[model samples]
Target: MDSNDFAKFLSRISSTPLRVLDTSIPNSKYIYLDLSYDNSNLEKIDASSSESLSRFVNSHIKLHHALVAFGGYNEIRSIYQRSNHFNINQETERNVHLGIDLWCGTNTPIYAPIDARVHSFKNNKNHGDYGPTIILKHVIKDVLFYTLYGHLSMDSILNLKVGQFFKKGDCIARLGDSDVNGDYPPHLHFQIIKDIESYTGDYPGVCSKNDLDFYLKNCPDPNLILKLA
Candidate 1:
């Protein structure tokens, strides 16, 4: 996909504000938010309880550890390996996170930060997967790349076409419900991609610990554009 055109595309749509969610509700059960997203000790987990179980999986499974989490434009993903389903991408041998997850309530408005063309999209219905997803191609300084917005409402894809052009800051998708968005608390999963590697709606949001080198190289820190933390 052409990324340079995408950079030029983002240049025109600067009217919209990017957003992060206030997930700290009375019963949010997220005690650690007060500390930091990169807290290493929080991940020391016990299988008997659900608290921080997601952290245990995310932290240990991936050797790189949390660089900068939560509030930032850092790509995020929800929980996995709570059970024994092979279809569900678990953090077993692979680090197993493909995109950035933004914590918030359901139907949180998800907007485009840069201009892009619809590279591909799909509704991947596997458990713990992106229920409804979209991928876009963008370019900056003649550099070709792409971004992925997953766990989005299925309705967002309606009337969307492969070649459809979207301006930056446009309302493109909404944070989907658990029933529609991989059965986790509502959030937005975003990722930056240097190359699509022939996948369409389905990209490897999760990667094996062995493959972190390649993924990190191709997937630059999204914070470059999304400084939302």
Candidate 2:
């Protein structure tokens, strides 16, 4: 099915509420982060440094977490420049982010949105990569899909095994620190995939401008299930 049809299917099947964060906390705010190329705020801070990212989040009072819009074409030049995995070449870079990032603190609990089983898990130990990641396989109304939880702590995968199941709202994992989470600030990179193809614990959460159409088709807007942004 196409993106629109897939979205409609997801909406229809998502009868249960999914909480990736502690929304029960009063006075906590979710700030929308504009990392797109046109966002001038990107000029004020060092996008590559985790320390800089931490300070940016703390600047706002009671800001428990920050939210990034999915399918955003971000101007994350510094972070991607360090790794060939993202840079690809001097001409074409993977600057467009496909996942929705929920910027929060380390050890913040992440819950499963629906009944799912561990499809794959691995520590992607590389600069600008998803440090410790987990992919959960799920099926709803006979439509099989997968959800990726990136930038997770080492402990999150310690006891996990392929086919291990988790119910909705179960604490599946926790956010990792910058050092272990691909050297970036603590956050959960969540993505929804209609088909994983042959990828294992790793998948392209960002894509080059030339490959945007293909990636967009394979990975739809995560908000269809998240319903947060």
How far is each candidate from the true structure, as Cα RMSD in Å? 8.1, 2.8
Model 2 TM-score, 2 decimals: 0.89
Clashes of 1: 16
lDDT of 1 by residue, 29-83 (tens): 2221312235555455443233344454344324433322343222232234442
Model 1 stretches astray by more than 4 angstroms: 1-78, 83-92, 96-98
lDDT values of the candidates?
A: 0.59, 0.78
Q: Model 1: which ten-residue window has the lowest total lDDT?
A: 23-32
lDDT: worst 10-residue window of model 2? 66-75
> For each candidate, what TM-score against the reference?
0.67, 0.89
Extract clashing residue pairs from model 2: none
lDDT of 2 by residue, 1-229 (tens): 7778987887776654355666463322555565566766657988778898577655632443434212232334345665777876867788778888877778989999889999999999988899999999998878899999999999999999999999878899999998899988788998888899999998888888888888888888776766664
Off by over 4 Å in 2: 15-17, 23-28, 60-79
Error of 2 at 167 (Å): 0.5
Report the error of model 2 at residue 171, Å.
0.7
